[model samples]
Target: MSAFLMENKKLLLDGSVIACVEQRDGEWEDTFICMGENMWLWNRTFTVTDARESWDDFPMEFILQGEVAFYMIPGVNYNGNFWGEGKEPKGLLDDGIPWRFAGHRSGVRAGMLAQTKEAAVGIFAAQENPMGCSMEMERAEKKGFCMRLHFPEQEGPRVYCARDSYEAGKYMETTCFCKKNLVFSAWIVVREPQKQHDYAAFLDKAWEVCREEGSVRLLTDEQVWELGMDFAKNRLYFEEDGFAGFCMGLTWKDKGWEQKRDYLEIGWVGQNASLAVSLLYEYAIFGEKEALRRGLSVLDVWCGRAALPNGLFRCRFDQIRKWGGRIDNDEERNDAANLYSAVTELLEAYHLLAELGIERKLYRKTALAICSFVTQHQLESGKMAKAWFNDGRISDAEGTVGCYLAEALCFGWKECKSREFLNAARAGFSYYYKEFEKYGYTTAGALDTCCVDKESAIPLLRCALELFEITGEREYLEAAKQVSSYLASWQYHYNVQYGGHTLLGQMGYRTRGGTSVSVQHHHIDCYGLEFYEAWKKLAKYTGKEIWRERAEALWENALQNISDGTLVIKGQKRPRGSQDEGILQTRWHTKRGEYFGVSEWLVAWNTAFRLKILRKDFLARKREKSKEEKRIS
Candidate 1:
């Protein structure tokens, strides 16, 4: 034990606090006092004896170094670094490059979680100081991975992109310069591993601590839905070549719209199919003819042109007119998650068509064909490939990408009544859940980043609920509850402190309930919109009010920073219903602007999903209330 471990109870494998005033400097003077069982406060103050004009970036870290365990930095780093020189088993795109970022890069919460067989630990630093926070895992003298939480967070060598490639990244330096005195403090919690090995236990405790400290939620679901629907109908919808759909994304720059032509994508950024489903729901509830026409027309395009011989469809459609309707030579690869989303949305549209007494054969045929092709590709291990070439050849098969397929297959079985789809769904779900049980983390739900991420766990929650609803199985409901815990680990249960001048701060953006993308991407988005229904189902099935509360929290997070058309950022007025794809909760961002500014690429899916859930879940409830009133009258 080092001098920092003054308590009788040992918290870490090698109980020591590694302090670095500079990269080469030795440990700085500090004081540690035990507060409670397995809890302590490390407080220190730096009064600069010799001051320079300014030091923009300096390396100073106070790390609670420990043995390598199942390490996770919420939405930031996952299970150590999965980067190396060669093509390794778990390498991501831009393979062979090392990756790490500042602590604020973590999703809703800025904390690190680590677990050994015997104990689990959570480390967090108050963000009140000028020095930001960051977590790193690298080989040291010890054989295990240690938790290195940096005070005055800094990413050196090169800064990373929160979106895709890091080749264009800028170098960033940490600064604790010019200050007369700097005070830094951190909270550390150590506890025995849960008996059932609940991997998210420490994260839950951290959330409790955060709640005790403070957090904020600013918007309600109703307000968000109204603003979101207005944006979707006015700005997102487009029609060309007899095809109607939502654009992939929109942008406002130099005080005007930047995208000169319409770009349509099927999923991820485009979310054309999902948005179409929302339009159909609007027609159903509000008797809107325009919504019905646009929704059906969008579905018609995919069903007529995009479907391939193997049942998989082309995901990109922007080049359709440019290519004179011939897009076979395009090099675009179809990701499993996007394809799954397309199929799910198609099935939903098919059901709506049937209800409204409209022709639905095309929608049904396309959805079934897609499901059949996906089921045919399942491995003997019950795992599905992550992406495939246009000709049906598997391109990449890794991570929990298959989790999305499982949910899609379950939906297929429910609508199409195919045993193959049902069997495939069950096998796929079981395989992924067992993998989660073993590793205690999910991975690669986002196509752009291949690492442990919260998005992958989302399908497990949906699939579990689907199976439970289909078979009335208690075990599946239990699985849903378990997966919800893992998903919660990625959610911010507290508000992250940001400088008042930053765009997010100006908007009073609440980090509470927003989800971080992947470990490689260090920003928050409304991705939690996908998890809302699963949480609500869990609440209904288990009578757990926490799940319901989480459902609302996730909803609010998804709806934050939405432009009411009057909202402006960087002198550009946001079109009504437009919300940025990324909320820069940290200094790291995709756009080169204010470090804490929102990524102003007003994405269609932001409004697409909000409108979707609003119509499907909330508006459906209101419809039921109206029907009951009519019966009573």
Candidate 2:
């Protein structure tokens, strides 16, 4: 520990040792390493205030078995249970590691944790006050992993308790007392010969180095081609309905139960249908029947027997009993909120098949059915009900629904040359366009008063771009650029260090993803899996490298985010560092999901999309080279 601290001090970029510790009215503070002048490199504000008193030992700081050091800062809840009581739930859960909690007034508020013992691997967060902790899994007890920071007392400095720090356009909490806020960052020390779970540490460090190097790498088009192909080729295969049909897809074993595609889940058939276009080309090149077969399976699932008898996409199967079939043998769960996704995916599938010289007769019919359902059920105001059911009760109106389906309608009109379809899309656009005009970038697309989010924003962005392509309307292009610019600000390009783990370079950024929240209502981590493609389209529409640069940055971060499954899963020769699709992880640092199969199941759809994006970049480079060669000649 002594030599580790010595080496750590030298790497701190002007860090100083201060073994000061103190506790007042149950609030704990430890004098973490101090920083010298010019803290702006980290984009953080740092402060050092003389305390009323100091102790020989730093409170809440301890060296575990003379190998690991841990620190827990005192914190309080601005919201959630015990807020009025001036207390918070027991602090547990490390930084960077994710957890899921639910229900009324049940919330976790805490500060950052960083471990820099011999090797850097542990939880970490930045010094952002009023930070709400999301998850404290059921396993936290057995693992002895818990939140170290908790609610500040009823009588602490009002500076840390200020909620007025929230700015209109900013997402992170800022303080007027910038100079008073403590900013801590140091390397976590690590010794060799630890458990395999610790490899997550090594991967994180390697990811940081790669990000710092991505912009400067000198690789040829051939080399880039190879890198993409390697990533695309690493996919898990599966046999469904005896065709060796699908790649690992949306459905995966979760808590011993199979989560399926019926729900139009973000990671399931919806994603697969979108990827089938690329998979067809993959099949053409490699003669891999699985690629073509999976593409067909996507069609069958979206439009064939898997679809509702009434032609609506099923959001879930109506269950009769555990592991039983739908209650009526073919009952459907129709959350009309996502009809746009179903229609758009089906449209893509139809186009790919038609181009490949495959008959899309059935695909076109299913696509039309969904389109007709929306137009028929749509209210005179052009607002579609949130769900399709016998009761016909409206659930919610989200802009995402109108825009996504509108784009599909445009495609439908183009294919069939149908005036009704084009007019229907126009009506949906008029309704959604008003919403956009009213709020612009802040459009949440949800009647639930949701904030503008990456989840809905990405789809809206694509829809706007699609509309622009079809109509050559400046409004559509303007919409795309406005949303793209807003989302770009959401990217986490700065640095964060806690315990001993640091997120810098490319590993610290996520250009393709954004956080989702309903403002003062709630906040949660969200994966913008669809943004990479939308950004690519946006780049082409605008002819700007900024959008293209965002897509490339996201691709790099996606590589940085492969899960450390070796830590939790056993019996694999090595950790399943990356997968072709079974489970989808929302955040980069942890392999787990907010809940459900994502903790274990990898979906084929996710991997397919990942491979497709790499392919896009691959072809992009090839095209650039061809144009450059022509110019040179």
Best candidate, TM-score:
1
Cα-based TM-score, every candidate: 0.82, 0.54
Task: Give per-residue CA lDDT, model 1, range 414-484, as digits (tens).
Answer: 88689999999999999998888777678878776666777888888899899999888888998887888
Residue-wise lDDT of candidate 2 within 389-483, one digit each (tens)?
A: 42233444544444666666777787788887777777776676565444333333333343333344555576677778877988888767765
Q: List pairs with backbone clashes in candidate 1.
A: 57-174, 58-174, 68-144, 68-145, 103-133, 103-134, 108-492, 131-152, 132-153
Off by over 4 Å in 1: 1-6, 12-67, 83-101, 108-110, 130-139, 142-158, 161-184, 194-199, 212-222, 258-263, 319-332, 472-478, 540-546
Listed per model in order, the count of residue pairs whose N, CA or C atoms clash below 3 Å is 9, 41
- lDDT: worst 10-residue window of model 1: 84-93
lDDT of 2: 0.41
Please state the error at residue 30 of candidate 1 in Å: 7.8
